[model samples]
Target: MNFDYKLFEMINQFAGQNQILDQTVMLFSKFGPILFGLVFVWLWFSKSGKKVDNRKIVLYAITITVFALGVNKVIELMYFRPRPFVTYAVNLLSDKTSTDPSFPSNHSAGAFAMAWALFWHRKRIGSVLLIMAFFMALSRIYIGVHYPFDVTAGAIIALIVTAVLISQRRLLDPLYQNILQAFRKSKGQKYYRNM
Candidate 1:
């Protein structure tokens, strides 16, 4: 706990000194997940003649993120870890005031899940997203919203879940294929194809 507090203080100390960097991090931390998710959706549904394997990767990533979030919720319910702002006098940059449990950060979980998913298929884009995800998690800590351990645990969970999903393709392939078949039969097929 002391180490977590010291690290949080060290990171949060940088928030108030630079206005531009602070604002940039704030915006990215607040909306980076959405942007990444939208990018994945666009890649999944875009009619760019990309292989279906890529789309499958996106789907698996999305599924893993959603599942990991659900697991986070369950863990939150079981153990209530208060946010940094609630527990300590820290430099808070963002205006977010939530009483949610801070043991496992949803933002970090989702970001890392997407990062791992994308990295599994598209190396370059995935690497960029992975860096972005790491910064996003750091921003959460820097903004005094989460502890280092919370984000670290979230990241570990995301990686474990992603690895499991990627490795167990035999069980997942048929299920995903059925979902894709249903999607193809739907009316939105005109907007996206080849999967």
Candidate 2:
């Protein structure tokens, strides 16, 4: 892979001036996925007056997680590309200590998976999450942690997973609903009484 020194220099200059941007990048890289998962779980458990189907949410989460893992594994094993920091000697403005394989970034995959999964449930929130995921991918490139190709591949994988999950939703919906019903029954939760 050819390195773009000019692009790298520009990004490094931007990182140098924007300390907050670097911190935000790290924060999102570390906790964004966790935050998204927590929101999903919270929405699943809340017994609000609205008809929020816990089963659908659970199904979406599970499917997305599984698919993202599969895509990440395949790309990592097949590509085996080294990270930019691993390839060259450079002082980055952002912390450059990552051991993960560089091709098809896991952060991008996870972010997209959560964003797409939540999109079906909450359009507004999902739209915001999608934008966040895009920026996170860009940050990975800016920080020299990932190549542009890696982010591109990750986005494609995420799209495929999201499409498959959406297509199979009908078949999985009943099983998901049954599982939720079982959980509600076991807990003796009043929310399931109407069901």
| Highest TM-score scorer | 1
**TM-score of model 2 vs. true structure:** 0.83
lDDT of each: 0.87, 0.72
lDDT for model 1, please: 0.87
lDDT per residue (tens digit) for residues 117-177 in model 2: 7776778878887888888777777766777667767777887898887888778777776
Candidate 1 Cα RMSD (Å): 2.4
lDDT, residue 132, candidate 1: 87
Candidate 2 regions exceeding 4 Å error are 1-13, 47-55, 90-96, 190-195
Off by over 4 Å in 1: 47-49, 188-195
Candidate 2, 172: how far from true, in Å? 0.8
Global local distance difference test of model 2? 0.72
